[model samples]
Target chain A: MDRSEIENLIARVALKDRAAFDQLYDRVSAKLFGVCLRVLNKRAAAEDAMQDTFVKIWKNADRYSANGLSPMTWLITIARNTSIDRLRARKKGHQDIDTPGFELIAPGLNPEQAVVAASEASRLSGCLDTLEEDRGKAIRGAYLDGETYADLADRFGVPLNTMRTWLRRGLIALRECMSQ
Target chain B: MTEQTDIPRDDDVLAAELVLGLASDKDVIDGRRRMSTDAAFAGQVVFWQERLTAMTDGIDPVKPPARVKKKLLAQVFPKTRVSVLQRVWLWQGVSMASLLFAGYLGVQLLEMNTRPGTQPTVLAAQLVSDTSGLQVLAVVEPVKHEIALRRISGEVIPNRVFELWAILPDQAPVSLGVLPDSETVRVLVPEALRSQAAQFTLAISDEPIGGSPTGAPTGAVLAAGSMTEL
Candidate 1:
């Protein structure tokens, strides 16, 4: 849905519009589910987080504002934070969720098909190209392997501070390169 | 040579650490606290959001169990007076509660205006943030001024006066002014802040019931807004 339409629905939801709230749920649940799965690393846990996030959104619908951020961003922020909270609660000494890296599924594809297939994959590949070797590896290791900074430090045989600096510097470089 | 600015130049670095989870427990705690009050850091969050959001794509989509949605539906459409999780997640934050309260009040005021024997000309509204997230701490929008504020630890807001500060990215916070009266304070925003709504904080401080003596925040913060912009 567009911004104005979403805002209007939010306004109605603030006024206790239940149908609008349902519509809002239909629009963003998939993306939110993806975030939950990433953090929780389990379908059941991710589902739990999604439910919690939307419930929080429903109760807090009145707090929406044009001054702060877009409605989608607001919903995503809620989902991300709620998932993080669940992850914190389930602290099994695991930080990152175990996930696989992207690969080019089909080599020769049409333009639209190619985009549909590699939208994020292409962005990651491009952004990865601009990163320094070690920083890129550090980010990949932590994010893909679900390794914490401390864990990464132990694996890399570096101090915690040094690992932090590497990850921090790596992210900055990636953000800069991608923003352009 | 030494730099003249007090802004943390390593903010991007800090943001990176945050995404990488390389940030220490202190960084996460401090970042969350600062996000409550600091507008610039809020913007930094948005920037990081756009960046790290792509990383989420690597995960394969999984269909969740039905019980989850059933429980969620139960929470959203609660049969009783708000659920437990709702109160904890929605109301715990200083800004979120205030904002929801203001919105409730705004809806009431709007409803009242729509009643018979009333002639409403302009609509007034206030936006508040959830304490759980980086958001506006408190907001009271009258006819003239839209009073919005975020939480800042150790920020001093005196009895009568309100201290206003402009937060900039990679720069020191600049003072806007002290709110002399509670009526409607229009803060003259810096040019840099015209495009930055999320990184600046408008703090109200207690003074001699008149204004600030030192031209900066002199008391604890009464209200503030998360610097996250639309």
Candidate 2:
């Protein structure tokens, strides 16, 4: 995706320009739907999630540029978070993950310099593959499955604090591998 | 900077944990608040977000079924809905047929007007619409500013009421009132519209039991015609 092009569309959408919103949806909906499907797994549920994701995009577009993340990150993160919110709602007593405060930032500040170039970001999958067997699964399960530490501890049959420590260490190693 | 030791800083772990949603509810809430106030901590969170979001780069884009876009756009930009009666009146253009029908009713009414002077006593119109059997003959008593109506055809749809309206040129349809269940009914014209009564096109719409909640004609127009001088 052309980052600036997506950014430009978002800026227009912030102004409530319907044409730009339509263009932006055409440009990114396929990718966002893919992300929703990955997290939700059911076709109908994923479709619903995708709808909600766009509603949020239309409503929150004004808040986008102030958020420090890149445009695609802002969008995909919304799809991921919306699907996960729906997923958690299905189960009884599951803790609701609040939509993350991605918009919390000083106005006029852009994080373009801090953003990992798309090329280097692609190394993330390879980095995950290089991790010791269980570590990769743990990270993916937590990130994609919306599993909490308690859920992970039960799945891996470890103590709760142990799961936390394990995930913390796994993240550190994963970060190191990605940077390489 | 990469962590040189086995352990890393609390903010790094917190940011990563927060991104993956591994943080507890309380911690996540606090994390959100901190991200708003603490720019450095916010950048740490964004770094993980950018990296982790790339995990989906492998997920192939599936062109969604077309209905999704259709549904989305309808919700986003809804056009004012045109009712079946309005479509007949506006698009199928039964308005000309209505005028012809009104002229026929007018001639008959004129022959019956034996007790008249120069002043017109009764103005008449035949409310007719195509494709629906609904037809009405409206006799406007010009002096009293009242209209007496009798249904010629079509049944009052169950649970729906017929509402009378006076439509003037280039203006919205104004509600006269809901027609009673009986075939013959009388409706008083608003004093504001008394002068325009000579040039008025009266219409009836099928509305909810109490009539259109909004003042305008919200339901399907059953029948309509321009008043003819008798």
Candidate 3:
């Protein structure tokens, strides 16, 4: 998908253009549905999550530029985060990830850093492999499985403190490897 | 919900934890607030979101079911264009059955080109309706076996064609044909219904571009009137 085309559609959608919104849905829904399905791991839940994702997209497209994420990243984040919210909602007293489109623009990455970050994003898979196998699984399980620190501690049979320490080290190592 | 006392809270790791949803519930809330004020923290959070999101790159796109779109459109656009305009059509007066007849009468008169008062129409009906600006004058020319119509107000809906229907006393409506987007139209009277032309009620229905596929009128009846002898 052409990044500019998606960006153009999001800009048009921000203006409340229904035709552009429709086109945008057609262009991006499959990829978003896939992301939702990966996180939710159920057909019905994923479908509902995808629906909610689009509703958010329509409501939040105007804020896309202000959030300063790539168009696809912004959208997939919504889908992923929405699906994870549903996954965690099954557990009582759970909090959702930051609502879609509300991601604060990080100041650390300049345009050049952003280019580096984009390349780093592509390095993510390799970096995951470079981490200790258990750490890699812990990261994936927390992200893809919506595992909280307590949940990870339960799953990995570590104390909650140990789980947090282990996962933080994994993230630090992964970040370092990607930067390299 | 208190900050974890495990290790010194590394901002980069905390940002990663927040993006990964590993943050404690209270931390999730606190982290989000901090991101707004601390651009560096916010930037790290965004950077992590970007990097973590690529994890789904291996997931194959799945085209959702067609019904999903159907249900979504229904949810999003609950009020159809017609209801949004609040433009109801047909029978500002007259009983329901007879009102439906005006569509039939209009169908019979649709093809004849009779000017008002040129010669007395064998039959005529003035079609008007509540919540509508539609006013059509239809007349049956007996000799030509045709119906002549003059639209005085209202309009053809964009992208929608208007259809003419003929309704007899108790029978289902029979389609005349799709009406052109013109002020005046001439429609041939169906040979079978000519005997009941005086009792015919003509109606106009809003339909798709090529008109209704089901021989009967398939859309909202916009105008209708029962025929009266000149």
User: Which candidate number has the best lDDT?
Assistant: 3
**Candidate 3 C-alpha lDDT tens digits along B25-130:** 7788888788778888888888888898888888899999877767676665554533422232332333332334334455533333234553434566777677
Off by over 4 Å in 2: A66-68, A93-101, A107-112, A115-120, B1-9, B79-230
Model 3 Cα shift for residue B158 (angstroms): 21
In order, the B-chain TM-scores come to 0.31, 0.50, 0.48
What's the lDDT for all of these models? 0.53, 0.76, 0.78
Worst 10 residues of 3 chain B by lDDT: B82-91
Lowest-scoring 10 consecutive residues by lDDT in candidate 1 chain B?
Answer: B150-159
lDDT of 1 by residue, B63-145 (tens): 55557666776676553323332342244565444444444345754554456895323211222233322122333333323
Give per-candidate clash totals.
31, 0, 29
lDDT of 3 at B112: 35
Clashes of 2: 0
* Docking category of candidate 1: incorrect
Evaluated on chain B only, what is the TM-score of candidate 3?
0.48
Tens-digit lDDT string for candidate 2 (B1-230): 12243455489888888888787677777887888888778777777887888877788888777888777876765422212223333323344433433343445433434335633545677799996778777777655567878665577766788999999999999999999876578799999989888789999998999989989888888899997754
